[model samples]
Target: MAMDRELVTCTKGDGFWTRRILCTIRRLVRLSAKSSTVGNMAVLILSISCIDGNLLNAFYHAAPSSEIIRQSSMNSTISSVIFKDYDVTVMLFHSAYLVDIEQTEKGRVMKLDSLKNGDIWKTMDVLVFNSWLWWYRRGPKQPWDYLQYRSKIVKDMDRMFAYKMALRTWTRWVNSQVNATSTKIFFQGISPSHYNGSEWNEPGVTNCLREEQPVDGSTYPGGKPMAATVLRSALAPVRNKVQLLDITLLSQLRKDAHPSRYNGFKSMDCTHWCVPGLPDIWNQLLFASLFS
Candidate 1:
């Protein structure tokens, strides 16, 4: 019994030092909110390591277009005050073909799956997990047969068994340390990006440029039932080990947040999010999960 091939390559994070991260996030948050200057200064420090450097284009390879927003998302309202007041750091990795996790090992890509138990988990205070949205896709041709898809999954591997191994690996690695309570791991539930506006019944635009993007915390369109269903099923094993950030449901509600209107071009991307909206909500929720 093993996970289907579609998701075999999509394994995301192996939580190692959970307790240490939780404490760090809590402390940083408390300290950052005490003073505006301290918070802003802390943001500068945290933002430096947050950079992936390999990112090139915003829509395509831009340093995880959502990273800046995920950070800024914490700065929006009282949440900004809360996050800035602390010295906590959220280390996350996101990309377009992340589901292709295996191919990552072959090149210069930063592979989240390659992380051993205590290896990189020791490097950060909190690790935000994510990976999905690309698994159920037929790539480009819309392999529209759902039954065929499900059968393909069952025939290829036993989904439950695959999850068990993944969870075992992650739990073993994360629980090995006593400071597990300080480390917190969260999985940003499958985020939908606008591939074509037609999926939402609003046909208009596609693609995004970093310069013309919206600020952090703004909502926009993008979602699909198939992707959500697949993610829900795949996330079953690590349910207790990681908090699921439900960005999929929220993104579906904010349909008008697309960028076509601001940039004057049909760039209403539905797959990934624009700044100042959804990604911020994701970050805010991550912060609240740590404290509350």
Candidate 2:
């Protein structure tokens, strides 16, 4: 029988979250014949934040398979693709938030909910989740009709409070539903951005635009973000159940690894990292945690 192992990574955006990890897995499989020989090939299933057909296409094409299956489209909530010979099946689900939260976009307020109701969680054997960057937005950039808590709805609440509440809901679902023995869960820690040059001791720079190297040190000059602290605090109760992939400090040093203007040039994108860059390291760490 083929050894079945499941891994899940939850994060926003198509950049550092999914593609980098996918690429790392693909490379590892290619390098190690042990993956197929030991009948331990990985079948990656994802709960995607948004639909990016191009990213899926790129992954499928780069993989070692002739019979590639495309089961859904951009508008669909779920999409599946199978790598015929490699025993890899990737399913992408559309989700913007880890828990039920109200988001406003283009004058329309949308309610983002948890994946607890979905059948995806039932089969999830390994899970990795991330949420940050989105929580910092304000005004029109921050898309939310109103903060929803139980029976109460407010115009706004403390970002940390909302984050902690959302995490509480998520942990509750995991504790109740997920099989602790069969499944392994991980939370990808807050990925830091290099928007402020002063954070890295360069005050004159505006953003991570033309920078081409990471900050030279083991520690970030500006120290960790309060979001990271909030994450740890929220996860404290459930830390035993879920492992935290602490990529914050390491990622903070990679100030120059962002897509910056190359992504669009419309605005500086210091949030997401460059593909064959820092995220690759993140995935390497993930791969180590999964197999080693």
- How close to the true structure is residue 91 of candidate 2, measured as C-alpha lDDT? 61
For residues 1-292, could you state the per-residue lDDT of candidate 1 as single tens digits? 2322212222111011122333445565444433343342221112111111111011111112223323333523111111222243333233322211222223232222333324544344455555443333443432222211211322223333333333344444544541434344555565545445455444664433222333235444343455456556655655665566676767665555544334434444445443434544554565467665
lDDT value, candidate 1, whole model: 0.38
Q: List CA RMSD, all candidates.
A: 14.2, 8.4
Off by over 4 Å in 2: 1-43, 47-58, 101-115, 138-143
Give candidate 2's total backbone clashes.
4
All candidates: TM-score? 0.45, 0.74
Best by lDDT: 2
**Model 1: number of clashes?**
41
Worst lDDT run of 10 residues, candidate 1, spans: 48-57
Q: List the residue pairs that clash in candidate 2.
A: 8-126, 8-128, 104-143, 104-144
